[model samples]
Target: MERLKKLMVGLILLCLFISCSQKNNKSDGKLKVVTTTTMLTDLVKTIGGDKVVVTGLMGEGIDPHLYRASAGDVDKLSKADVIIYGGLHLEGKMAEIFEKLPELGKQVLNVGESLDKSKIHFIQENTPDPHVWFNTDLWETEAKAVTKKLSEMDVKNSGYYNQNYEKYKKELERLGEYITNRIKEIPKNSRVLVTAHDAFGYYGEKFGLEVKAIQGVSTDSETGTKNILELANFIVQRNIKAIFVESSVPKKSIEALQEAVKSKGSEVKIGGELYSDSLGDKEHNTDTYIKMVKANTDVIVDALK
Candidate 1:
């Protein structure tokens, strides 16, 4: 009878251990998520909160247009439960690899791909400008798409994701209104936003500012002498006071424009650097998307107001 009792106790303990292991596996063994850019990682964190482990392939200040994923990156992505990328060909060399990853049964989400087809303007063959984050209104839509995808993948935490997403979406909407109101402070004629590249078309379009670029839509586009001359002439003719440089692009382009204007007896200052391709350093005010827009707003307001 004593031996039987001991055996029964051991069986009960084993069953309890198995049940505990199963419960833990169901709750928090870590749901691995991989994002193509730091921007997406920020959005994912806003939705996933601490329930998911998120990693960004591109670091802060890194331009997504020229990024080449390493072998280690491939291995990391291969292990993810979901792979989220900006798509719209923003990944450049990694585009094909991302498209094919879904074959491995990973949930590959192209957040920008969910945009309304009519609202998209293609910058290249089968590629829409991946800089959709410029328009806070548009970005709120994308954030909702991200929340839906993440919730679908990890339904156990759906409520948490939905709540966080709602909060973030409200913040994004407030940011949009803030920009619209602050930009109104600048004289209507002074609303010209000139930058190294044409990244701000959406921002300008959304906020009622005139956007000009020394380079084409992509920073990868080489600035031609004709383009520089024309931009300088426009600045001189319009009496545009400030030309902005982007943090990720070379300042030489903007400097050249400044010199061109100066040679023609017109003065145009470099309106503080804007966070164009990527957000500013992790410690800076432009670290988060909201902070980034505010930093850019402050610079634009001070320069153009």
Candidate 2:
């Protein structure tokens, strides 16, 4: 571990040296921000507006749980005036890189860590579920955190950031209500969500749906055979008509589970895709955070209703 740490330090410092020369060249004299997940990137862009130049590390269908910072990502981070990311092990693979970033005198923010820690769900003793964005209320909280970060980074645009945060947070609150009403459309007894991984614990708790997943909180963890058997039994026993596949995770696990149900003389539909760890592509309806939530809710309501 010590050797690995040294190697990472070496890599970060080297990138810092290379990026230091590019600091003066902003796209339009904006605060350059680097974010981890597509959701965070969108949130920051919304909050920062025209005052900030935001670059996202993870793109559409990119899994933050298993994402490692490439050489180019490090260079981006080094050039950034502020670095922000989704916390709570969502970017578990890049934890070391995030940790080392602060030492380079760059303002680094873990957007999710600003919330009341008690509200966070722990899948294990130290492992908290990192999909806090699924809960729109929590997303609102993180938006304010982003507002605070942007204000600090570019004090001149503090008012602009505040205005945007207020506007966006309201949208998130409405989104929470929208999801609630949509979930209600599903008969109460059928209010169960099964997905590729355990990314929706908070979503289930908030929306009053019982969520079951094949894998644990982090996608880095593997799905166990016993888990597959138990989850297959669950869908069969509950008469669940649909299970979901995440955009970022491979469909095979859920497909395998679907086959398991078939073996037990039942059929579970794929329903449709849900944007779990990341957002959808630019042309898709789920290209943004709000749109992504609505799209997922639409899929859930239509199939389960």
The TM-score leader among the candidates is 2
**Clash list (residue pairs), candidate 2:** none
Cα lDDT for residue 219, candidate 2: 83
Candidate 2: list runs displaced more than 4 Å.
1-9, 21-27
lDDT of 2 at 282: 68
Error of 1 at 290 (Å): 0.4
Worst 10 residues of 2 by lDDT: 18-27
Provide C-alpha RMSD values for all models, in order: 12.8, 1.8
Which residue pairs show collisions in model 1? none
Q: Relative to the true structure, how large is the alpha-carbon lDDT of every model?
A: 0.82, 0.87
260, model 2: CA deviation in Å?
A: 0.9
lDDT of 1 at 66: 82
C-alpha TM-scores of all predictions: 0.89, 0.95
Sequence-dependent TM-score of model 2:
0.95
Residues 1-305 of candidate 2 have per-residue lDDT tens digits of 97985787677766776676564566578899999999998998899888888899989999888887788887788778888988888888678767776666768999878989999998679988888888888888999888988888788889999999988978888889999999999999899899999988888888988999999888888888788889999999999989999989999999999999999999999999999999997688788999998998899888888
lDDT of 1 by residue, 96-208 (tens): 66765655455788987789976776766665777788898788888989889988887888899899989998899899989999999999999999999888888988999
